[model samples]
Target: MICVDASGVRLAQPDKVLFDGLDVTISRGDRVAVVGVNGSGKTTLLRILTGALRPDSGEVRFGRGVRIAMLEQDPLLPPGTVADYLGDGWEVAAVATSLGVLPLFDRPTDQLSGGQAKRVALAKMLAENGVGAAAEHDMIVLDEPTNHLDLEAIEWLEARLVSMSAALVLVTHDRHALDRLTTQVGPSKVVELDAGRAFVHQAAKGSSAYATYLDARAERVDREAKEESTRKILARKELAWLRRGAPARSTKPKARLRSANEIVSGGPRDLGVRGNDLELGAGSTRLGNQVVELVGVGQRFAVDGSDAVTVFRDVDLVIEPGARLAVVGPNGSGKTTLLDIIAGRRAPALGQMKVGSTVVVGYADQHAASLDPDITVRQMVAGPLREPDHEDKALLERFWFDSTAQYAPTRMLSGGEKRRLQLVMVLARKPNLLILDEPTNDLDLDTLRSLEEFLDDWPGAVVLASHDRAFLDRVADHVLAIEPGGTMRRVPGGVTGWLEERSTRRSASPVRTTKVADAATSSSAGAGASGGGVAAGSRGKQKQASSGPSPSTIGRRLRETEQAMVKAQKRVDDLHAELASTADHVVLAQRGEALAVAQGELDELEARWLELAELQDG
Candidate 1:
């Protein structure tokens, strides 16, 4: 059944056309994934679909009794308690509990942090669960749902969506979700919006539709390139004719002459196509051998003016030159605080934190406070530098802000644009040590990819705290985790390794509590709250009293061992493929190292499988 259909849609922003004569249909059970470069109107299309905003032209028709629940990228909730807002529905409570926001039921909604508020808002939406009597089936629209979610929460949300009996439309940059969760329902279809036009590819369900769309898009790109080449050739001829001041030029229509001129001057811009050679400029500072050091460094805080809490204790870590570390933990875990401490914005309550003399830190916190809404793009780019100059203009253009936008106010820029400007401001200083707290929060796919590419070869020390699994895997060489009870440990296996462990833990313990759920009351919750740490980790090590697998548990152990082996081998194969295809010297070196690690892990898995097999045979 058709849930909603949009026909002849048109939306335009004074200077740019967002959508023109676009058509879209969302049917029941359809899991549509909307993807495009930033400013390509994905969000606007979503708003149009839900009928929250009317398009300049066209009509959106909803099937009888179509109830829509939307999770906007940033939602506004009226001031009230979380419970007051979500109502007392069991399903809603269950979702809130699972999302780790049940503890905030009594907390004023307005007082919650941005991340907390996001979770609360999501919980309220999921609480609806698309099962109300108002509609035949609920249509759920989510924009960047995983932006603030941790690995475990993301996994839980993915599970919930898979089980949900509703039509789902989402916009996200998470490749994993696109591959794993979403699948075409009924007839296969792909609806991709590029600039204002919609391109639909029909094929088999699952990845086949996505694959077909990509192939078709690539062909279109090739054809356009060829057409542009021909246009340029003709434009050059026209220029020569015009230069001669021929009498024939006067007979030609002025509009035709203008078109010829535009063709000669780089032609009319296709805002949708960004030249792949996007540069994130400003090389980093020359780092000395030492970057930063923490000796017995720990943080603690007083909660309710009584009990003292430990964020982390007796943590010893050294940030080496050109090091890449990803800080990870549950919500409220001192990931942000940790970054602040390392960046010298905050001092450790205990132990010594030392910064290398050569280190000039560039910090971009979650709040993006460095940005000034009243300032123009040029002003923001110039920042502390004396004045905006030609170089600054060039830099802004490189980051995708054209001449007009460079002079426009920063407040008018889209979320993605603001993030791009923020990045420009941060990197322009050429700091040797870079600390990014949730940097991927507002960045679009293009910007995220560009930043990841830049960081790959950046000659500096970097520390990032983010929940983006793809981003973490691409950029982090190591991981610093704040486990429950404020135990800070350097985990093995970067983000991938940590993810595997997390998955295992979820399977072993079905009911896990994040710091957001247990922060106020648990003894160590105070430590997590006071020290600004997150209370999440393995439920300690599971006790293995038996030397070998017990007869009752042997079957489970055998299955687990087999699964682990398969996963390890897959990692080895993926690493090998990456190593073979990569051309960048730095990337090849990184992949080579990853291949070695995967090989070692595969060997260990094989050894463990053999041990488990022997135990079962006995």
Candidate 2:
């Protein structure tokens, strides 16, 4: 059944016509992804789909009694507590807990952070698990649903979306989710908007829709290139005829020649201004040997003047010239705090952070504090200057903000556009040392490619935190991993190297070193709260018993537990898929029970797997 049907639609803005004569249809069981460059009307199209905005001219028809659960990028919280907004139910609790928002149930909705609000909104949409509010909705439309989500939460959201029977339409930069979208009954589809036109790519059964879209887009690009060549040839012939004064018009001389003149003037601009890769300028900085170094760095906060809580303690790291370091860990692992200390934005309570005298730091912050929403894009870059010189304009242009976009306020920009603007603001400073946090979050695919290209050859020491797998693999030379326990270690390889050992890390033991001094805890939880030197690295090895389970036996059990965990997880996924594909109430109830059982078994198996891994290594 069709959820939304819009044909011959048109929308326009002050600077450009977003789209013209657009035709779109979303039906139940269709997994559709809308892709476009920043400000290409991705969000506008979603609004039109949900009937929030009326097109200038079109026929928009929804299926009879259709219902849609829409999640916008900036969601408004309803007036109530979190628990009141989402009903009291087990299904709701399960999804909310997965999103890391269950702890906020007692807090007022207005008191929650932006990330918390986003997760709460997501959980509300998914709480039904396709048997309550979700089942009633004929379609679900979301915009940038993965922006504030962590890696684990993103995975859970992907599974939940796949398990819903409602039609799925979303705009996102998450590459993982785009590849795994296999709907219950229909093939996955991608609608890419470019140059006021929409191109549809549909994947065949059991194939990756995103990969198919890339191949198709490449072919279309080649086709457009050939067509441009033909146009150029025709224009040249027409130009020669016009110059030769060989063709005489009857009455309308210049008027009849207008069409040919337009053809000659239009090739790339008429198509679009998606030209020239992003260029980054680095004003020369003579660098010494040292970049940024943190010696015995640690931070702790006092709890109401009664006790102290330590975030991380006794850390030491050195960054030199030409270093490419990627800080990675699960969310809330103090990655951002470490980066801030390195940038000199914040100081550590227990250690020294030294920056080279010649170091010019340019920080692209996750929450861009420099972006003034009320100011124009050009003003944000040029500060208080009444007239931004030609260089400032050119700099903004290089980052895909054309003249019209430069004149527009930053508040008017799309999510991706705002991110691109933030990058411009940071790079305009030409700092030799760059510290970027979550830099690839909302950037378009093309912009990401351009940034990667720039970082590939740019002569600068870079440090960043990102979850984009491809970006991390291409840009980082070394990896710094942080655990929830505040343990930091340098992984030999970057993301790829760490991922290679992720499956077996459970059985791997932390390498211990003899710290000639005592390691002291800064928290009141431990007795040793003060020390002269960093003692964080002296984790004494747990001696193995000679009469307990043999090492070989533990290794065998570890392998067996891993196999069982994988099997049980696969069973859970299969059950979710089956539950989504069916509509019979009785079948759904039965499958739900089985799914719960399977999930519990999977969790138990995973816990056992970790225990065996520790036993094997310890």
Candidate 3:
């Protein structure tokens, strides 16, 4: 059955046309997604599909008696508290609890932050979708549903959506959600909005719709470039014939001549720009001995005039030059608070933080708090200068803010455009230390990849908190996981290891209460695998005040221990597999012998690694 059918759709903004004569149809069990650049009308398309916004000229029809639930990017709640808005029911409670909305149930909806509002909206939408009821909405549309959600919440939502019977339509920049929904459990469709056109791709029976669409789109762009080249060649030949053949030129057919002239004057097809992604030049300032040091740092928040709630406690962190640290944890687990304290935006409840004299911090917080909404993009990039220079204009263009967009007020820009502008402003000053909180939020995939590339060779210290697993894998050298109850751990295998440990724990205890500090993983680096830690590279050495070996000596030993630990772990795994599958007594004996040796080596490495971590903490 058809859920929604729209044809001959056309929408135009004051500056340019969004889409023209676009056609889309959503059927039962269809998992459809919308993808595009920041201001490429993704949200606008969603609005048109959900009947919230009417197209200039289009035919939209919904299946008879089919119910629809739509979650907007920034939903306006009815005037009331969250409890009043959501009402009472076990189904609502379950969904709200899973989404971390239970705590805010008594708070007024209008007082909630952007993330809180998004979660409330998501919970309401899921509840209405008949999570545990017989009659549910036929279709559910969500705009950036994964925004502000932690990794665990995102996976939970993904599972819920997979189990539902309702058709799903969502817009997001999350690669994991997109890939899993479109490939793992799907016969999905992807609607790609590019260059004022909507290209709908239908996945094959066992194929990945999103991946296929990307490949096909790149091929299309390449084909267009080739055709443009062919046209130019033909046009050049015609020009030569017209200019050189003097007497015969007058005798040539006037219609053919006009056609040739038009082709010669016409510009090339707008396949895309050469380098639309952000180009980040590393900071020029040389970082001193100290980057940012935290001693016994902790944060506490008072709740509803009651006792102050402790977020995290006793976090002793040292960020030196060439260090790439990524923080991960569930929502409201003090990831952002830790980053804020490091950036010196807010002082910890109890701690001593020392900022190096030579350090210049460039912070990109969750919200674009530093921006003035009324100012134009050009004005923001130009700083206090009266006008943006030629270089400033070029810089804006590189970030995908065109000439028209550059002059437009920042308030008018899309969510992604605003985020991009924030990056431009932050990097413009060239800081040696970067503290990014949820930097991947609202950014398009192209810009995200470009940033990952930039950080691969960035000569500075980076501390960021993100729920983007792929982004963390590419950028972070160490994984700093803050479990619920403020017990931070250092995992060896980056995000993958942290995820495995989280999954294993969840499996072992199906029902567990959070915020009760686990005694097993007491502090940041005392326990757990110890390969992922501060990389005191050749660029600079840390200055240690405690009585011990020099920073360089420990750093060298730490690197050596990490490499040996990896080999030892691998050997142990191989031997264990051999012992499990073998029936030969001789083979079993040999494998056992090898396993013992490998285990002993791994234990020594872990102890040495832990000792180094304690030294760094001291």
Task: Write down the RMSD of all candidates, one decimal each.
Answer: 10.3, 17.0, 11.5
Candidate 2 lDDT by residue in tens digits, 1-618? 999998988888876777787777888878989887777888999999998999988889999998888898889998999999988877887777667676678889999877679888988888754466535688999888887775556766888888777889998877777777643347578888887777777878777777888898878787888989988998998788688784455656666477679878878423333444554635437666677777667776664474555666556666766566788765555678888888998889876878888898889877753478889999888778466788779889778787888999878887778888888777777788888898877777767778887776556678888877777777775577664445566654556566556535534843211110111132122111111111124223232335555333453455457668878989999999999899999999999999999999998888888887676445
The clash count of every prediction, one per candidate, is 7, 1, 0
**For candidate 3, lDDT tens digit of each residue in 1-618?**
788999989898887778888888987788888887778798999888888899999899889887888888888888789999887798988888778787788888889988889999999888777555754888989898988888877888998988877888988888888877777354688888777887888888767778888898989888888888889998998798778753434545676677778889986654434452454554348888788777666677875686676677656667776677888888878888888888878988976889899998898988874478888889998888577788777777777777888888888988888888888878776888888989988887767877887776566778899988889877776777776656565665678877778789879977544332332234342211111233221112342344665443454466557768888899889889889998999988888888898899899989989998777545
With a 3 Å backbone cut-off (N, CA, C), the pairs that clash in candidate 3 are none
Q: Least lDDT summed over 10 consecutive residues: which range in candidate 1?
A: 526-535
Tell me, by lDDT, which candidate is best.
3
Off by over 4 Å in 2: 130-136, 182-185, 244-256, 269-276, 281-286, 302-306, 385-387, 492-618
Residue 24 in model 1: lDDT: 76
Which regions of candidate 1 fall more than 4 Å away from where they truly are?
130-137, 184-191, 201-203, 208-213, 249-259, 265-268, 271-282, 514-618
TM-score of 2: 0.77
Give TM per candidate.
Answer: 0.79, 0.77, 0.81
Report lDDT (Cα) of residue 55, candidate 2: 90
**Candidate 3: where are CA atoms >4 Å away?**
184-186, 231-273, 282-284, 512-618
